[model samples]
Target: MDRYGDSTQKPRVHKAEVMDEISSWDYVIVGTGPAAAEAAVAIRELDNRGKLLMLGAERQLPYQRPPLSKGLWTGKDTVEELPLRSAAEWDGLSVQIHLGDAVIELDAGARTLTSASGRIYRYERLLLATGGRARQPELAIATLRDRVFTLRNFQDYERLQAAARPGLTVLVVGGGFLGAELAAALSRQEGLKVHHAFAGNAPLAHVLPPTLQKVVLARYGKAGVQLHPQHRLEGLDWEDGSVRAHFTTQAPIACDLLVYALGMESNLELAQQAGLTLDKGGVLVNTELRSSDSRIWAAGDLATYPDPVWQEPCRLEHWDNAEATGRAAGRAMAGRSEPFRHQSLFFSDLFELGFEAVGRCDSQRVLRVAAPPGGGKAVVYYGDGDWVEGVLLWNVWGKADAAREGIAAHRPLMDLHWVETLET
Candidate 1:
């Protein structure tokens, strides 16, 4: 059942006397996002009588984030595509929500939280669906720094989308997935010149290995994107018509606009203050998504939980991982003791070039298998010798579920042996 709201019906309200008894809730979800929204639904499924209170950092209702990065810019997706739940739908859940504010302080021992506005909330059990912040360097030209955008939330997307125009030179600073995707999408514009300036040698340096990089680089080259590798931006100079991105060693690259896709930093101030364990994978959690403090459970990109699929601890920022872990944490909070055995399905849309990937798609793997090319569509299997760890399908269609299952089984390609060559 959709826990957000029912448009066809009216909401039933409890009497003033009954409302007085509901001072606190059985569960308090502090970040009203997809994770928190899903958590509320999952909690209702587990215990109908459980009181649920949600606190959002923003006033707007939680929305889908994937569109903000890739789809929204292309005009293929409308503003309606951004929302995960409508105001009416979220109201239908009967969960008390305080929008436009975040929990600023948390006392795990006392099981209480204080918001930015100084309102205190108490929870029996909690879910840290707190999101991440945009990772970027401080730019100069304070007045025109408005041109230096970072795509994270809806507002940022709107600004960048409106500003990026044909003939506009955009310097995207980051070598990660978001940076590359933005470059690819923006480069597709008729006259827009897109320059990808990153510290890494190649785009998607943090992820995609040589096996997948070759194909991706080829696509970028075909698209005519100016790749500026190993340019750690030292400063920025704002011109009357453009902003110049300066590097410590390389020549200054000036652009009409600059948008940094430098990546995201997990919002961990509250989590860290609460003394939750932290690592490279954000906030650490167990197999069941329970944090060091038993009363708190975390999900979404902020959580670095055990990935049973890959037998490693992973902190993923994709929608699939967030949806999976959010529901899992909600269910676990409701007494489900099973480990997270689900695979994280991540997808990136670069105009026509899109991919659905699972565990261990990044570099540091020596294995790959390139099948025979059929009509420009190629299937590449990557993983250890025994199993298919990561699968890349070039121009393939409708194979997401099959790809995930294939990776899970770790099935090695039979007709083709594992090799690091794209020669088909």
Candidate 2:
């Protein structure tokens, strides 16, 4: 045997090695939410040759989740009207979407993933846009899990709409945006009795100012929606398909339908299992949206990345934030480096009222100014110093861009000079 005879002509030739084929892609993004969809589209725009795979646990194609609670209750078609992109657009994109299939395991070290069907997928880059799951009542009993509802997806709204017949007693638990929105929509159904167990003094105590909270409470009152303020759910009874909801501040109420809109819990199980760095219950990433593992990145609600504007680590779940973060991640994976610096855009429409704004909405102190009798708008400023932290354009249209700039501008909180300038 010749140990070193490579120079000899026709001495020895090694046969071509056959590599076992495993499912592989240039990019594998988990979760079919806004972040994942936007990321895939951006990636396709930049790199046409890379194989992209988007995994979603839900059966439905990727659709906007906001309208599910916002207006789906008003007889909107789930499949026909709710897609983020049209069918033709989806077909045009070179993305392999795995609907109803979820990636259950992620081996970051191996740069591979395993879906629920035992398929191994190797990826050059991974994005975990696996958005959060809706939170439910802690006292939910076993038999009642199916009966109780939470509005996190389009299907949930469809189910709730079917059960929202007249003469039904619906008990909504929570004091958050979803809870308020759902209760308001249900209250419009004549003959249906809607009771909202708000665990705070106001419907949106967590975000809205006390003044604005009053306005919301008044709206709920006018709509015939009963508000059980400062209340908490103790337990639930699922007997004969009816919910006997017991609350701490009120007596037991028997209801035909029970829906709770408690906040959401970030879907961090996969990231945690892979030993990714987590902080404040979210996967921590730098401004580039790169996670601790380097191979894996995160975006959307599940990602807590440094906010370049605020100079702090923040997690935003709004549609704009998701899209922005997703595009940023996609660009980076395509070899483009740029920090994602933008304010979060959030908006909510309840019944007939709608408002949109940017920047932080949490500020205890605000300068509330009412529009002149016919001005058709009002404004709230949360800035006390040079940093204009927030601005609320109540009933104001065509001012979102300017308002955002104002909030970003280092305007004095409120001075006679600034006030005169504002008036002018």
Candidate 3:
């Protein structure tokens, strides 16, 4: 048995894979998300004939979600274009693909899993890559009609793409990455009412500092996005194919569509139901990505592995982090005893302002900024006393390598040079 702990929870078995006699599979991954797919691929790369199987609840092939909020709103892309890999590729790799069937229960003691379709799968090693789910308010907007949408998967985006039209009012809730990206996508459409609401002071205040937050908010404000900060939606009025939303401290606002960008909830029901341990925030895994049970292993959004660099349990929601973590977990499961180590990194583009951040943002530290007057781009470094901990940049592309290197090297501010790289 193995165990790991996070935030405020006792170490529970994150994974425990006992040998199964019914059938033998070297590795059986339980998700088709980035983590699952990457793990499967890595397993194949490690052992040519390892006998692997991948299970996905969604019928669609593994696809990227980042573009759904961007291209779907713009009508420039479709679900068919977002698949992570083609069926031919999966076939080529001889990966057993089970779509639309969700694993409902795990028998860690017996090293088996039961699917919703009543199929029992036996495995020597198990990987739980079940990613997180986009959260929503307790109740639907009173003003919400069938047209209101939230893009959680390809199908959700398909409905949202069909609903976004000219003269439509798009009310975006939350100001984080999803909300901002969805709002930005709507800004490109003409004659659209794009109103953004947030409970915080500015957009992405959790991940960015006040100065950078202001820049993002200002950019959105200029895009004709009505800002309503410190506001909470009380209810929505739906009538005659339109919706009117009631606010806490303001008059009711009417809109044609509402998109909620609230955070995400890690999918841990299967594990929790099986008596696996869970941290307050997510599944807890140690350096080996092994749960207390030792029979199961978890990675990606579902698994909160320890970060060797930060010396804490950190979960990243970025594409690269997910891929790297998945690969590491897969390698570790395939008999590699290397420790899992990955630094968090994320970036986004909004018209004129490009935002990027490395490591976790520490609000307690001082932020040193490097930007000229009236320059649209800047890099903010987060330092804990004398050592640089993280770096964030705006209008700074191709410089992420330098920023990452600087942070990793613990370069002092005195030794760093900031040269203007913006094209004049």
Best by TM-score: 2
TM-scores vs. true structure, each candidate: 0.85, 0.88, 0.86
List of clashing residue pairs for candidate 1: 4-89, 5-89, 387-410, 388-410
Sort by TM-score, top down from the best: 2, 3, 1
lDDT of 1: 0.74
Task: Return whichever of 2 and 3 wins on TM-score.
Answer: 2
Task: Give the per-residue lDDT of model 1 (tens digit) for 1-424.
Answer: 2222222232222211223222566888888678887888887788777778888776556778777767666778777656786656766766667665668899888788887656677789999999787887676457567788888876677678778888788989888777887888788677899888888778876655565566667777788888888899888777667788889899999888888787799999878888999867488999898999998999998999877776677898988888888899999987876788888777777657666666676465636545464544555556667566776655565666676666666656652423222233
Residue range with the least summed lDDT across 10 consecutive positions in model 3: 1-10
What tens-digit string does per-residue lDDT give for candidate 2 at 46-153? 998888877777665567887777666666434466677754576578677766557888888888887665667899999999988888676547767656788887
> Which lDDT tens digits does candidate 3 get at residues 371-405?
66886867776777657777777776676666666
lDDT values, one for every candidate? 0.74, 0.75, 0.73
Q: Write down the lDDT that model 3 would get.
A: 0.73
Q: Model 3 clash tally?
A: 17
Clashing pairs in 2: none
